[model samples]
Target chain A: MTIDWNAFTPWSALAGGALIGLASALLLLANGRIAGISGILGGLLARQAGETSWRLAFTVGLLAIPSLWLLFAQLPPIHIEAGYPVLVAAGLLVGIGTRYGSGCTSGHGVCGLSRLSPRSLVATLCFMGAGFATVFAVRHLLGA
Target chain B: MNKTTITAFAAGLVFGLGLLLSGMANPEKVLAFLDLAGNWDPSLALVMAGAIAVGLPVFTWAKGRQKSLLDEPLKIPTSNDIDRPLVVGSLLFGAGWGLAGFCPGPAVVATGAGELKAVVFTLAMLVGMTAFQALQRQPQPA
Candidate 1:
C-alpha cells in the first residue's frame, strides 16, 4: 500500500499523543480515575450520586477546550465520508460496543496498555483488527 | 469547584487538545490511517507510541501509590478475564470506527465543535447506549 506522504504529520501526532498520555497520567495521579471517555460519559447516564459532578466537569472541559482553541488556531477542515444513516449506525455500534467492552481506544488502548493490562491488550487487538478489516471491506469489497 | 473537579476538568481539556492536535478529530485523517490498502498514513501509530512512552512510566509510578493526591483510593481495573462481551463489543466498536472514522472521544469533541453530523452521531450514540442499558436490565428468558 502507498503511504500518504503529503498528509502525514508525524510530529503533530507524536506531540498530541504525548498530551493525551499526560492527561491520563494527571487524571490518575490527582483524581484516582481512568480517563476513559466511555466510562466517564456512561457514568452520567447512570446518574450515580457524588460521581455526577466530576463527570460533568470533565465533559464540560472536553467540550469547552476545543471551542476555546478556535479563538487562536483554526481547526483543520472536517470531512465525513459517510452518510447520515451510516454515521448513525456507526455511532450506535461504538456506544454500545464501548460499554459492553468496558473501554475504548482511550481506556484500553492508552490507559490499559500503559499499565500492561492483558485484557486491554486483547481488547485493543480485537478492535484494531476489526477496524482494519472493516475498512478493507467497506473501501475495497463493498466499495462504499 | 474543588481541586478534584478542577483537576478532572483540566485533564479533559488536555485530552481534548491532544485529540485535536493529533488529528484524531478529523475523520479523513483517521480513515487514512485505517486504510491499509491504499494511501495508508502511519502518523497515528506515532501518536500511540508517543502516548505509551509517557504513559508507561506514569502508570508504573501510580501502581506504587495506594491513594491518589486527593486521598481517594486508586481505582484501576483489576479484571484479567477476557470474556465474550469484551471481544464482541470491541469488534463492533472497531467496525463502527472504521465505517465513520469517529470514536467516542472524537465524536463528542466534534459535537462540541457544532458539526451537524457530529451532533447527529452523538445523539444516535446516546440512544444506542441507552438502548444497551435498557436491554441489559431486561429479564432473560430461562
Candidate 2:
C-alpha cells in the first residue's frame, strides 16, 4: 500500500492534542474526575452502586465519537498484522494488565501524570519502556 | 454524575476529537508509521510533542491554583514503588500494542473512523477486559 508522506499534516496532531488537553482540563474544572478508563470500566464491572449510569454513558460516548466522525470524513482502513488468535490473546493480556496496573494510558499518562501522581509516573515509564522494547523485539529481533 | 465521571466523559470526548484530528484514530496510518522499514510516518511524534507542550502549561496552571476546581485537592497516585504487577502489566500492554497497531484511544477512535474491524476489535477488547475481571473474582485455592 502506498502512503502520501508529503500530505501528512502536523496541525491535525496539534489540534488533537489540544483537544485532549482541553477536554481533560474542562472535565477537571467542571467535574473533578481524573478520566481514567480502568477506573471507569472497573467501576462498571464491580457494579458499584450508582456508578453504572455514568459508566454506561462514558462507554456509549466512546462508541459514539467515531460514528460522529464518519459523518464528516472517511474513516481509515484497518490492517491487523496479527491473526484473530493473536489479537484476542493480546486483548486479554491488556485487560489483565490494566487491572493490575490500576489505570490505562489515559488515566496514568494524561490525567494522573498531569496531576503529578508518582505512581502514574512510574507506571507511564514502565509501559512506555515496555512498548519500545516490544516494538524492537517484534519488528527487529523476532522479525514477526 | 459524580465529579469523576463527568471528568472522564469530557476527557474522552476531547481525546476522541484529538485522535480524529491527529490521524491517530486511523490504524492504517499508525501501521504505516510502524512500517518504518518501508515508509515511516513520524506524525505521531508531533502529536506527542503537541500534547506535551499543551499539557505542561495546563499542569503548571493547575499547580499554581490553591486547590483543584472540582475538589479540595488534586488526586495523584501516591505509590512510586515498582512491583511485579507493574512490570507484568507494562509487558502485556506493550505486547498488545506491538501486535495491534492501535492502542485503546486509537482503537476507540477507529471505531468512529468507519472501520468495522475496529468495532470488532473494540468489542473484543471490552470482552477481554470483562473476562479478566471475572477470572480475578473467582475464588482461589488456599
Best by DockQ: 1
Which tens-of-lDDT digit does each residue in B1-106 have in candidate 2? Answer: 4665655565676767777777766655665555555455667667656765666667656655545665545543557777777767756765666566666767
Compared with the true structure, all predictions reach lDDT values of: 0.90, 0.65
* Alpha-carbon runs more than 4 Å astray in model 2: A1-8, A76-81, B1-10, B31-39, B60-75, B112-114, B138-142
Candidate 1: where are CA atoms >4 Å away? B140-142
**Which CAPRI tier for candidate 2?**
acceptable
User: Residue B96 deviation, candidate 2, in Å?
Assistant: 0.5
TM-score of each: 0.97, 0.79
Q: Model 1 chain A, poorest ten-residue lDDT window?
A: A73-82
Global CA lDDT computed for model 2: 0.65
The superposed Cα distance between candidate 2 and the true structure at residue A98, in angstroms, equals 2.0
TM-score of chain B of each: 0.95, 0.77
